[model samples]
Target: MTVIAVTGHLHLTDPTVHLVRAALGRLLAGHPAAALTGVSCLAPGADALFADAVLAAGGALVAVIPSPAYRDTLDAGYTAEFDRLRHAAAEVLVLPFDTPDADAYEAANTELLRRADLLVAVWDGLPGNGRGGTAHMVAAARRAGIPVEVVWPEGAGRRPAPPA
Candidate 1:
């Protein structure tokens, strides 16, 4: 079985979302449906997109929630998508944390890498803003010898980082 994990920005533009979906579809095309498994955190942007593609491709999905209160911390706009992905996951593993903090997110990222044979990074070819971001995870995956496929389709750009 091919187990793929996803890491990316949470705030993506509409066009970027479509591009990401198409890119994921292309990446998953060769793998047999039953032999494919996608791992994700079900976060708003790339994570959610990857999970959707996995399901559409008749592949199993495994969700690694960052914390017990992860749902509570989601933006209202993303609540529906998050709930849908969580419900559709073949397996849901919530880390041992009460809130969605940096530590919890890092732990979740670690678990994702541990379970994945490959990582699909929807990145902008830039450094991550902080510790648990997509760039950090991509670097970690590479350091651990996990193959990472960076997907940044043409014209895709990131939303401005939130003020610190």
Candidate 2:
């Protein structure tokens, strides 16, 4: 079987990235793909880490940009890495049909999940405050029958976010 897609949250630091990189390496080992082909939104946290890991492992990267001109309006600090991944992506699937409002983010995330066969979530597991919504999306993916592999810091699972 061809390797399925991998999706996850994007909110990791350097050390977290190191751990996550290793986790992904272990998880992706022996997958039958000339390279990994998956969708990443290029967000700073877990998204960038996932994308970077894919490229580092000699896998192809597919960027599912949230909107047409998102790079123009993304956070200042995130621009460079966004640019790097965007340029490095083997192909880009721009969802320019909608701008990135709350509804749009949800829509984009749903689309990301729709294209995936598996999801790898790396969330802090703090309570959701309507801000970072990857946790919710992860739940949604699980409901949709996509296999989910969760990666978090040592204490994360012990403190999962409260239910909606």
Candidate 3:
């Protein structure tokens, strides 16, 4: 079985969301569903997209929750979707963290690497705003010699940050 893990931005632009969904679906179609397992942190954007694609493709979903307070940290608008994905997960691995901080996120990413045979990065090849983001996971995958499939579709763009 091939175990694939996902790491990417959580704040993708609306257009980029569709772009990524199609790209991820195509990539996932390349594998036989019976022999595939997808791991995801199930964050708002790319991660949720990947998990949905994985399920649609008839593959197993393993959710790696960063912390106990993870759901509380997300916006209320996203909680329903998060709960749906978490419920659909074949296995849910919660990291040892009290809060959903960068440290917990990084730890979850590390757990993802330890369990995955391939790392799918929905990245734009840019530096992450902070630690425990797509770039960090990609770097870690590279260092661990795991194969990485980058899924940045043409015209994909991130959402602009709101005024401070």
Candidate 4:
């Protein structure tokens, strides 16, 4: 089976979500359902999109949560989707962290790389927000000798950052 993991932005523009989802679906369609497995942290944007595509493709989903508290830390608007995907996961691995912070996220991303045969990144080729972001995961996957497929569809764009 091919194990694919995803890392990406959490705040994509509305239109970008549709674009990414379609791109991911097309990508996953290349793999036979019986030989496909997807691992994701299920973060709001791209991660959730990837998970949905995996399920839609008849692939197994293994969710790696950074912490038990991670879901609680998601924005209220995304909590329901998070819960739905989490419940649908074939397996859920919760790291031993009480809080959802940078350290926990880094660890979770590490685990994702460790388990994946290939890393599917939904990055925009921009500098990441911070440690454990998409760029960091892509670098980690490369350093570990895993193949990476970046999916940033044409015309895709991120939502503008909210005022500080």
> What are the models' TM-scores?
0.97, 0.80, 0.96, 0.96
Kindly list the per-residue Cα lDDT of model 3 for residues 20-132, writing each as its tens digit: 99999999999999999999998999999999999999999999999988998887899999999999999999887999999999999999999999999999999886779
Candidate 4: residue pairs that collide? none
By TM-score, the better pick of 2 and 3 is 3
Off by more than 4 A, model 2? 1-11, 155-164
lDDT string for model 4 (45-162, tens) is 8999999999999999999999999988888888999989999999999999999888999999999998999999999988887888899888889999999999999999988755
lDDT of 2 by residue, 1-164 (tens): 32334445544545766777777777666565584565778776667877887787677787877778777767688898899999999888887654666665666777778778777777655544352276777777878988877767563332232353
Instruction: Kindly report which residue pairs in candidate 3 clash with one another.
Output: none
lDDT at 155, model 4: 93
**What are the root-mean-square deviations of the candidates from the true structure over C-alphas?**
1.1, 4.5, 1.2, 1.1
How many residue pairs clash in each candidate at the backbone level? 0, 7, 0, 0
